[model samples]
Target: MYQKIIKESNENKIFQYLFKSKENFVINDIANALNMSFPTVKRVVDILVKKNIIVERDKIGEGVGRKARVYGFNPDFCYSIGIRITSHSFQFILINGYCEIKKEKLYNIELDTSSIVDSLEECINNFIATLNVDEKKHLIGVGIATRGIVNNEKNFVEFSNTDSFPLRSLESIRKKLGVPVLIENESNLAVISESILGLGQKLNHFVCLTLSDSISCSTFQKEQHDSFSFKAGRIHHMNINPDGNLCECGSKGCLGSYISDKALILEFKKFFPEINDFDEIFSEKYLETNFGKLLINNYIKHLAIGIRNLLFFSNPEKLIITGKICKYKNIIKPELLKAIYTPNHIFYRGEDTILFSKFNEQTGILGAAIFPIVDSLF
Candidate 1:
């Protein structure tokens, strides 16, 4: 059993290495990197190749000597479906093994679980019907990215402010879809996406801050055991201000209350009663006004406080900001940095430590889709 565990560990390492690099590697290169014997590496590689997970991509060297074959993961080996359920819409995406979106569909619907599950079934069926039989054979499973307290181990959503979707709803979706289903907190998935495909890719320690209807944070770090671990929803309820406004969670000055879209909208209404949507609030017409600047400044100040608290606690190498608020990153980033550098706080990191997410709206979905693929390999 010990020998088997070690062998599986090596295989997982090799798979993760290839998946991350996206480069074709020869047996010698993998063996050296993994600190394993060439024979053992070759044996594992052969198994992966036969399983259609990896393929011989190219050959190096001319006819003068035996050409070394380079291998890489086959991008079409398997596919995953990612579903993002929000307060007003459902986003479905079909992703290939390479984490590329093959197809996507969006539906604006009521925020009830029954409606969502019904819509999801239709979407999955329509998506599957579009693929060729051979391509369909590669379909592995589905992942649902949601907002709220998710019991990932049980594939259950314990609670959410958006709607009343119970744990059994996940099982219903799985039974109807006839595939393995995974349910995870959307913020957590966003962190996963950043870690795998965005700015956090190479970082050993980082934090992801998502500002949407509510504020959320996820932290990633390499543990003492040399294994990666993450904690989701750690910063939402953190008290950033003691005398600040009340939050939906019934707390005063919570991070979520200060930086969420709802908070911004409420603050905007105080200055510009006519503003409705985020676009209007962030528009040049509003931004040029004193009220707009004031609103933005206040928002940035509060956000900076929350961010400062995060940095003080985690001291992460990088902080990635995602969600709807990132659209105003150009205007907000500088102010946020300034707030952080004020005399009240002492932060040594440069401006480069902060970054906006690269994947935009698809970040959560892509992360959800990649979860099963990563789980299968590791």
Candidate 2:
């Protein structure tokens, strides 16, 4: 029992070191950091390295004497392929071990059945052609981020309203692509990316609310294991109003029915039918126009109500607002704060802070890049 307990404790210590440190450590450094014997630490390192989770760095300096090699997560051992397929465009990126974009491509494509797989293949082939032979072999897997109900387990998408094709057959694309693939609902992927590297980094629990015309939420709960991995995506489609308009998802009074980008655009068009382009509808010069201010104010009101409904069950440390709606944060900060503070439950300290995504529009791409970097660490 004591031996097993000691082994578990050592494993925990190793995890703690990896979680907190920015730089890599050799066996001796780990031993010193953990205040354990060198041989014991070396045994732990050997186990982790054998798991292909951590990597031993090459020895430096020419020496006849014993060389103590540096060791850390391999920055070149794995790569994560991240693909973000949205209504307006599709983005694909190849991330290297260091969580950097080694190669990337973005283009708009028609969301159709025949075109979907072809587009994905073309994007992958084009991106792969740019890489030399050695880099091609290091690809660990591909991750697909798309809108609608995605089956994470089978890498199948159950449905997508963006197009009339069978996107649910993404597994076939994976087999053709010749790599393991992970299909994540886009909103959930967004939250995962944020939880790992964005505003949600420090918080263990939080809800990422996509404030675009397509409103959705992704929640993250850090699983308490030997490491820092977490469970993500418990989306609840709560109705914002019973008498509200119908949503694209075929629900009435859904939050998306009131505050989705389409809803906002429809609201604005009704007021200013002459404005067709987004730039004109939300132009800086147009803010002085009565219609512009009204649109902005109305948007904030609906947003506040939507947010209030989210906070009903969750007491997240922070509420991260992303997508196009974040553009209005500066314009509606005062009112947004007021709405969040209106409720005064005993548990609701009203300390819920709001922040914009630092990575902003590039969150999906960057997050895709991080998957490989994180895999290297694990």
Candidate 3:
């Protein structure tokens, strides 16, 4: 009975206390902060250290009797693999306990599920081969963040109309890999990491919207316990304009239909056939061109509408714009600001805090790499 009680307590206490800590802490500090007895906290810390779950670092004190040891999650005790599979490429990253990427590699692979799995497996195996034999013992599990509908509980890709629908499960690949695997929507994972570890760390509520070739939103909520978590935001197929061109997602005026970089590229091609790339058209000289201003205006207007929808629903403390869209932030900021200044929202009275996603191009990969550690730690 005593053992049963201790085991149950361990589960609830350890995670609860760690979740409450902003960062690493000494035993005494944790005890004092949580108002728990020193001996109890010390005992728990010792047990955790012995289990290789938490780490101890010695700290020197100027006026103390004995230097206290600070404890942190034993980042090196385990390893996690995160892969971001996108429509255009796949990026694999190996992260240790401290959320540091020990190794990272990227490859361009076909978007087909089977081909992606094959390429990813090759990369993982190659990475493992390169690791020193001793380090292999620390590998824990793998996490994958991908574009499209993911059945989180089932660890499967439900569908990705970007390529096909009714997609087959990723379970077969996971089984061959022979480790616990987690598959999540790429945008959801991005928000989760950004909220817990990235710039959103300080905000209680926020929306992280990825404006790549696709537009998706995710929301972060602060729990009563003070831990911040994220959930995927709404994804609608509505068009940006009733008269606008149809989207691949079968939407008439969806944000992706007009504001996405792909959308802009297509528009530029139609208006300026001589332009070969979006990057070229967005060059410095183009900024002075009437065409550039027109592109920026329409892009900002569509984005503003989409962001407005998100704000109306989540009432986020901040809204983060990420992906290729961030590159044109200087162009879009003024227009986005103008739209937000006008009152369409009724629930919140003040201005919404707007932020550019600092993670930028690394958001998907970094967030995916940190997923396993975040999962285990929290």
**Per-residue accuracy of model 2 over 261-355 as CA lDDT, tens digit each:** 66777877887787665446567766678877887787777777777767776777778877765655567678887866765644464644677
Q: Write the per-residue lDDT of candidate 3 for residues 1-378, one digit (tens) a residue.
A: 000111235434664456434368887777786777889888888887897877777675768588777778666776778887777777788877666778877777666665666666676677667676545777667787776666544444644565422223445556766666666667777776676567787777787888766667777677655555566643645455777778786757666787766787887777777776656766767656788778767777777788777777777788887786667677668778887667564546455478887777567667777666566555
lDDT of 1 at 140: 83
lDDT of 1: 0.77
Off by over 4 Å in 2: 1-74, 113-115, 152-156, 161-168, 226-237, 250-252, 269-283, 343-347, 369-377
Off by over 4 Å in 1: 1-8, 113-119, 152-156, 161-164, 224-226, 241-243, 250-252, 269-276, 279-281, 347-352
lDDT, candidates in the order shown: 0.77, 0.65, 0.68
Superposing all C-alpha atoms, what RMSD in Å does each candidate have to the true structure?
3.8, 5.9, 4.9
Which model, 2 or 3, shows the larger lDDT? 3
Worst 10 residues of 1 by lDDT: 1-10
* Best-matching candidate per TM-score: 1
How many angstroms is residue 266 displaced in model 2 relative to the true structure, after the best TM-score fit? 4.2
Clash number for each model: 0, 2, 6
